[model samples]
Target: MSSNPASTPPPPNRTSGDRDATQPQETAEREINPERDHRCESRRGGTVIIEGGTVVTVDDSGTEFGEGHVVVEGDRIVAVGPGSAPAQQGPVRRIDASGCLVTPGLINTHHHLYQWATRGYAADATLFGWLTELYPVWAGIDEEITHAAASAGLARMALSGCTTAADHHYVFPRGGGDVFGAVVAAAERIGVRLHAVRGSMDRGRSHGGLPPDSVVEDLDAALAGTQEAIDRFHDPNPGAQVRVAVGPCSPFSVSTDLMRQAAELARRNGVRLHTHLAETTDEEEQCRAEYGRTPVEYADDLGWLGPDVWLAHTIHLSEEGIARLGETGTGAAHCPTSNGRLGAGIAPVRPLLDAGAPVGLGVDGVASNEAGGLGEEMHQALLTARARYGPEALSVRDALRLATRGGARCLGRDDELGSLEHGKLADIAVWRLGGIDHTGIADPVAALVLGRLPKLERLLRGGSVVVDDGRLMPVSEAELTHELDRASARIRTREVSA
Candidate 1:
């Protein structure tokens, strides 16, 4: 097979995570490298053939699997074919995937992982009302609370097969906690490939935004903080485990001048940009009232429309807006779970895809969805798309692609993290398909996407196991539960005070 890339990220260096998992073309003593082999502690030569499952390869042609086997030599997928035997003379680690489906690791295009603590607080309210209720709780946050929340949220995503995620966390309560940096640290420790968008909001209630006074930043302070975070944590490598993007809150919550300034900073610093756009009617109303333009037009005017930018919950886009997004190559993160829970209108996903706009799936903030699992988001995405179109319009295959390839495109990281091809990073998830929901189904991918909240079997990033048997491998479940409870108790008392 040719080694030409199907979809690649723009020029930056590829990092360690993008290590080619394929076997080399030699009987070869020349293959040994101290840095890659000795320092990394990675195994070589042995093959891991996942046989017995239908492979859901979301490639250019679409889902095509006929009783295939994926040969993993080292950490990357070397060859995928019809249950082929390992041609080389080495021990093969075989996995029974006969009834299961082999898919790329799911990707979360946008999230606020720290918002897990805010769940169930304003369950029945609209977006703005809900934000108003939860912002104070968020404003009073410390590093301990925010880190725990981020860690817990990432652990949940890992257990659900999300190998990669982008988080847009815009809250900055003044305690020198560095919420954005802490989130990056949490994701790294948990072994999830993360793009931490250094998010900021400069407009408080005094500035006609919904957020409280304590959490908002000054415009210059926001830009400086973002720059510092990016310089410290953002890796411009292909296989980088951690990357930083700039997120200047949303249309209503930040000034237009700040938005443009943030975009310029991102381009100058060589990173990406993200934000919340057209999520609800209130946002649309604000854009119309304040900017005298639709949300899309306003974003375009602020220099926020481009391939490097991805907006969350673009559910309220007009026809002209859709065309503009298509023309500009901007991306959208379709948060089906949040949309359904909040009664936000279903996004026109069909039209967006048809128009050549990049659209990916996000679980959104747990406060809105009550849970953040990539697999659950996949289920929600397909269900929501089927609701908007016919059941057949958005297939289980398409939904999976949105979580993997589609998301990579949104983050402008398609070259490195999206697929299970030869050169792509060995970021993967394995699901054990053995229960009532998966039993009668012949296709495991179908069962996975359609099943009623099935557990994620395992998750691997950079060929390292982060989640094993439905639990985070590094941390104890009991300890996690205890910390979660303790954190909840403290936050509960604080909420009562507020």
Candidate 2:
């Protein structure tokens, strides 16, 4: 969208089947300096050893080490075991993690990063009312606003232990000036993996949808835009920093043709599909009234349920819907705080998990949830499950799994991410548990989930420090705050003028 090379998407190296062929070439070894600023350092081929912490692997075996060590070589985990790492050959930067808890970096399965500029609006509105109040304001967003909002949102996510985030941005107003590219650039600037869903909405209020007509694209344009996004930015390589997915907003705001065609396009390009599904009772009622079928049933008819598809919210599903999702191996992204904030009913999380569906946690959008932190989602998810179902509905470990391995499955990245196993990408989080909030907790994992969200001692994405000593390394938070403030003010002014 932009002629600037820095903003342009990288050409895809290989097809999905040839992921192994795109392995990063080794870089020349350099002296390891622990005290140097990590933001300015070259990350490739660097070795980092983290010892003297409780390592929760979240692997298939559910491995946990009371006092463990993790060795990172380049961008992959070389070894993970109890106690200190063995002898290393190169200059390695060792982090003494005596009072920390090491775990797989949290993965956010669903979000609308652009909404960061539109928070604190429609604070007490229902799902439909909120859309009614905010769609016009969202229509005022341009590339600058979107970029600022996405940067601030991703910065919050990184500081809170999220390494990979899926951002579903569907609102593309006329002359928005490359808002989607802005999101991708923000992810790059923030140094986190992004599943950028090029979302579209073809059903406007005129077509019995919730959003305004100004924000909805025609069916042809929507499909063309999605295709262009895939051609421009979709990366199929292993350990990809950015991947494109097809999303057509929600059923209530999308035409049936767009829904069917988006699914087909995703499959044809070997990419994934994402969308808001059964998020509220209003959505269910609308689907039933329009198609004489429940939301889940309607989706199945459109071929929207599969392993490559992950739906957001999923709060209004019935038993049969849950069974269908599991039978089809579909994934669900549970946004507990957002649901509670909007008075959307609690999702049937335990039932969905028991039915064999892959369940992950989502921060949704800050406009709805306000906090916009991935780590807090784990805590909210655990509390919501126990409050809705029973005390045994979910455990602290289960909550961690939902944020890590389960999220990896939802994104179809289980083989490459979501765990601290050998050969896996070194996306890890170290939480400082020595603080007052976590000092008395007997179990580090419990303190992480059941207690307060611990401060991140360090967050590494692909062996690069994203956060160190509870501070984001790549960019200044104050700069992001100022950018966000200006962006929000501009959007507000435009909305008022319009």
Candidate 3:
């Protein structure tokens, strides 16, 4: 853990496709509006206005405002109208969005934030090979290392215009410090909304599972920890920053009994359930070998398919499985980048969506998806769907939908978040389309997904500006980088080398 800068060089901080390290960090703590009235305590902070932008409201009607403004009072958006409209009757802080495309903040439905330290370790490996290589290293993670990696991941996501992310941290190695708490702490400090799933793996290689025994926990321990996380952090309030879910890794790595019990526990607590399913043909084979059923069928029998449950990387599903998922209102977290990276086939996203299933975008884990941002994932989703199916299969708007509204539905937060609408939580992202990557794009909203990703000009969560001018407001990039380097070094030296 040397403080020497050369010992661990800082990674590039790219806001978009371009590399610009010269952006000012001056607005890290700048108030939205200093002169605004604060007499109304309910407004929390006074009104802040985003003026002169093309607003892309991913609402039910696909509303788009040509030149509009969004007025925020406290944590909710009070008004959205033409930019020419006069400001409301109150002291306000105005953000000039003249050359911006303002859209609802992107949401990430699945992630493994702790994998930030081990991003490229398995770059050339397949899913199972990659997991085998990294399990030992990940098992050695302590609380401090987990915090560092999670903080870095959240900050990186925030810079890319992500306001909320659902993380699946399933590895709980013996003696590894508070894995769940570390993720929650990092998200809170980075000012991103978090859905922290207490993921578990009960069946190990000793029991014919994919994961090593060292990283697996007993069912009782997993159940107890899941409830403890919910009791301590699952907030049901509107605009809540943190919520907890129970996720027992995957069908290949968890016991059938654990899976059934986890679902029961999640339903009893009224919390959500998440896990990986049908990511690979090998997974399907394993499920068939063990349970005499497909992954989807096994999950369904265990009561894992429902509105309260969302599965990640459902790539190898059958038509029957697809119909069952859609019928049960189950959601899917589509990880296009990770799937492509690991040589996993393109997920049937188009068919899944067409089947009346909720589909959302996920970066998966940084291990498989080095780009690890919803901005990049959205573009990847577009390309992968088109690469397999025709270009007509998915639109830029469709990708944007998966990143915003679709993600909200997967996380069961559609009523409170996900769109640019009145009374919705003011989680917004402003993209500067004036950059080199976005030039000559007729539609800024379409440019966001079709063109090279635009720079994230600003990001707001709960009506508060947390990322301004493509820089994170809540955490220091330099400090996060330093800690991440230290943690990564520790894992490489102490664990990877072992």
TM-scores, all models, native as reference: 0.88, 0.93, 0.91
Cα lDDT for residue 302, candidate 3: 93
Best by TM-score, which number?
2
Q: Rate the local accuracy (lDDT) of all candidates.
A: 0.76, 0.88, 0.83
> Worst lDDT window (10 residues) for model 1?
1-10
RMSD of each: 7.5, 9.7, 9.0
Candidate 3, 95-151: lDDT as tens digits: 667667888999999999989988789778888898888888887788888999999
From the highest TM-score down, the ranking of the candidates is 2, 3, 1
Angstrom error at residue 16, model 3: 22
Pairs with backbone N, CA or C atoms under 3 Å apart (clashes), candidate 3: none
Query: Candidate 2, clashing residue pairs?
Result: none
| Whole-model lDDT, model 1 | 0.76
| Number of the candidate with higher lDDT, 1 or 3 | 3
Q: Mind giving the per-residue lDDT tens digits that candidate 1 earns over 277-382?
A: 9988988887888879989999888898998889998999889899888888999999998988888889988778877888889988898888778788888888
Assess the local accuracy of residue 127 in candidate 3 as a C-alpha lDDT between 0 and 100.
84
